[model samples]
Target: MTALRRLVATALLITAMAMGGTAVAWAHAVRVSADPAPDATLATAPTRITATFNERLQGDFAAMTVVGPDGNLWSDGTPQVQGATVSVGVRPLGPAGSYTVNYRVTSADGHVVSGSWAFTMTVAGSGSPGPSATASTPSADRALPVWPFIVGAVAVIALGVIWSRLRRT
Candidate 1:
């Protein structure tokens, strides 16, 4: 019984590890394009923040925010969704410096997604109107949770141990 359990436990662990790795790999949304592009200096600030993803997006854009260097919200309204393209209009930009465009959107497949970008404006126009910084802000955004792998791991490990113990006899 002991020997059988050990073999089963090992197999289970191997399977769990493989599945976890794959889950992390598959949960990302491939960004087709961004208006300013990451870390690009635009000839001029864009009037809108646009993101094109591999999948079509839904109307429920719960996490999009266009924050300027000064800590104010720049996105004029909710993001307008058209097919796979997502875009939000911006207020006029003030200074020529770095502006961070942070966004989170839901994919057609129901995945929660988030991302960000930075653009520099070299000249500040009078009343140009752009987003303001948050009371505080991070230079970039982070990824979301992976619940599938988390739940699958516990079950796989438990089953593997039980199977090994049963086979040992």
Candidate 2:
């Protein structure tokens, strides 16, 4: 019975240590900071956007969309990830106005975090955000079949082989 008690104590210590290690790993992710500082007022257009997190965010696949005062999308591409930070390029503004930066990301652990922030630019006009990329839209060609490309490639190769054989004969 004494030997069994010792074993149980050792197992509990090991379990606690394992949970502690996982907590440390997950500690890498909370949002530590952001540029445009959440609700900053700027005299001019910001050349870039940045978000800093406590944990290392999943790098390449994070998505970001900035809706300009005109309601147009200002993000040029998928946000780029570097270390714990993710950033994206911005579009030039024709007018100064309020803009909202809507951020969404999935952490390395697969948890999705989403939020929005607004900033004012004194430079003076507003435009509709260019397009709604965050929302899904219906497409006209949803019923298209995938086999046509495969069949066409085979047909073309067959035709080429026949022509070569005929020439040889």
The candidate maximizing lDDT is: 1
What is the lDDT, from 0 to 100, of the residue 33 in candidate 1? 92
lDDT of 2 by residue, 43-124 (tens): 8777688888877677644766777765567766678888778887776644677777776666767666666677888885
**Clashes per candidate, residues 3 or more apart or on different chains:** 17, 17
Candidate 1 least-lDDT 10 residues: 135-144
Q: Score each candidate by Cα lDDT.
A: 0.72, 0.71
Q: After superposition, how far is residue 27 of candidate 1 from its true place, in Å?
A: 6.0
Estimate the TM-score of every prediction. 0.61, 0.59
Cα lDDT of candidate 1 equals 0.72
lDDT of 1 at 111: 71
Instruction: Name the runs in model 1 displaced over 4 angstroms.
Output: 1-28, 128-169
In TM-score terms, candidate 1 sits at 0.61
Give the per-residue lDDT of model 1 (tens digit) for 7-110: 99999999999988786557556578988787888656677888888877777744556776666766676778787777888777766678788777777767
Segments in model 2 whose C-alpha atoms lie over 4 Å from true places: 1-28, 125-129, 132-169
